[model samples]
Target: MLPEAKYRFLSEDVKRRSGLVLGPEKGYLVESRLAPLARTEGLASVEAVIDLMMRGDKRLCEAAAEALATHETFFFRDKTPFDLFSEVIAPALKPSRAGRAMKIWCAAASSGQEPYSLAMLIDEMSGLRADILATDLSGKVLEKARAGLYTQFEVQRGLSIQRLVKHFDQAGENWQIKPELRAKVRFEVGNLLDDFSRYGRQDVIFCRNVLIYFSVEEKAKILARLAGMLADDGYLVLGAAETVVGLTDALKPAPGQRGLYVKADSGASAPVVFRSATAAA
Candidate 1:
């Protein structure tokens, strides 16, 4: 595979900005997403593309970051977590919502599907309410998320036919999510590594499938920050393949679940040490 010398500096910038580590394997992805953009602007090659990026053009910087990050996502991409979100997490947190409204954040929401799926689940439940803040590092994906458009394959992967009919309408050959459902979601461009001072506290955060790209050190930093963002009784949801092993002690596996972790109570915030590498058991 070719080293991404063309966008190395910008790639480093993305790592600094978002904590998403992109190595050589991602060179094709950058070339693929940005080559056309470069050609359209009459630039010669990927080196020229990086040159434009280094010049501090905000649009190029944003575009280059979007190019390197993966945006492939679907509604309820993995069903078990959503099941856990609805069945266990929400009910546990429901009683805590006496007079205050609940807030759920999708920290790495890609193209809005995960968060929208969450909103749809809430919509299905009567009076069990919450607000959703879906954020991604790439404004391009967030814009697509706000648009609520989906190709047939994108809609069918995890979205059930019944829910599909209820929440989407056919627009020519594509599906468009209903305004009522789409309106419930709020999309923003956010980097999980940065101080989330503006995002406030949350009851649940779905940061699934985004951590695999980070170094273990980066993952630890991101997890520590997420631990702070959770309210006393909040939970953090990670991808099935992701783990909190070296991250922090504030999270422990939800009882009877393999990939889920709940925030430990106030006194339990100390770092969890292990005697063995197999400590996850």
Candidate 2:
């Protein structure tokens, strides 16, 4: 176990770099997350990892942050948002972008599932041309996403058997996303704490489930940046548990939609409104 002081310091360090808050109760998490890294670096213990990190070992500190920052995500996670994308957002956004390619940004894309799922949906549309840019804080996960490979359990989660057979090729016990689907999306390492202006405005932004880790102040700041990066009529999809309420004035709930948000100035009207329905379990 890491000493109380060292655990506090490590917690603060993680927040400084990644905006993930870890309280004293998370000491076990800290120890478990960093123990393997310590071993891989030939350090004797988690305390040794912390010692080097506190001593200005940039690499060790980053490794610790990445380990702690990793989170679980599955394909088509929280079906409501994807359902809204397919049933409402896509059909509505298509006409406005008749001649140009629509851009979608999967912010906080852990591994590849979320963005790849979007790619599959877009490919199914007859006249829609779309590009998906998926970003994550951890380079390790981004590499895995770029490889487009998944174990059996990964493919089984939320992936319909027909979709799986259509989009993936078997490789031993794992499945690799088809080359066409893989080619439609690009993966990069991005930190929400940093500037995102360079990615250009996106037609749809999926920043789901990631904001719950941040403080309210950080959430507002991140939402402001997202608002700036969205097109006038673009859609924003957050996790089912997340919302724009009380966070920032830059976004408002899309009327009748459960997990969808829109830029506040986008002139949302009754014609686009639809009542919320329960997401598939």
Candidate 3:
């Protein structure tokens, strides 16, 4: 167990660097996540790792932050959102924008599943040209994402047999995304708390399942920043469990889509009704 003073410092340091709020009860998580780093760095214990961090070791601090940040993800997570994207968003975008390419940003794209899924959907559309930018705070996971490799179990979780055969090629026991699909996404290491002006205006932003770790104030700050980066007609998709309600007025829920929000100034249009084929099952 980490000493309380060290725990508090580490927690505060993580929040300062990454905006992830580690509560008192998360001491176990801290120990579990950092202990391996401690072992690898030849430190006596997690406390020793913390001491090294306190002494101004920037590398250890960054590794600690990466260790604690959640990277949980799977392909087409919560299928309804992808369905809505393919059915409503894609068709609406193609005609509306004429010849311009659509830009989609997956702000917390852990290991590439989310953005790759978006890429696949975009590839299926006849006339829509889309670019996908997938970003994460951890360079380690970003590296993994760029490689486009996954275990059988990971691929099985959210991918159908058709998509599996169509997009991935066998690489020993693991599956690697085919070169054509892999080429569609660009991965970068980014911190959501930092300025997003580099990403410019996005047509759609998927910052899903990431806000739950943050304090309400941080959530508001991130959402407001996202709002600033969003185009007037852009859509922002949050996790099913998350919402902009009572958090920030910068975004309002889309008229008929769950987990979808539009900029407050975007103006209301006829609601797009999405009925997922698999929802009945």
- lDDT values for all models: 0.80, 0.88, 0.87
The true-versus-predicted C-alpha distance at residue 41 of model 1, in Å, is: 15
lDDT of 1 by residue, 199-273 (tens): 998888888988999988889888888888888778888999998876777676666776777776544543565
Q: Which candidate is the best by TM-score?
A: 2
Worst 10 residues of 3 by lDDT: 264-273
Model 2 over residues 18-116: C-alpha lDDT tens digits? 989998788767765676688789999999989898899998888899888877678888888888989999999999999989999999998989999
Q: Candidate 3: where is the Cα deviation over 4 Å?
A: 1-70, 270-281
lDDT for model 3, please: 0.87
RMSD (Å) of each candidate, 1 decimal: 9.1, 9.6, 10.4
Model 3 per-residue lDDT at 80: 88
lDDT of 3 by residue, 30-115 (tens): 77667668877998989999999999999999999987885657899999889989877777667877788899999999899999
Could you tell me every candidate's TM-score relative to the true structure?
0.70, 0.73, 0.72
- Residue 222, candidate 2: alpha-carbon lDDT: 97
Question: Candidate 2 regions off by >4 Å?
Answer: 1-70, 268-281
**lDDT of candidate 2 at residue 191, scale 0 to 100:** 93
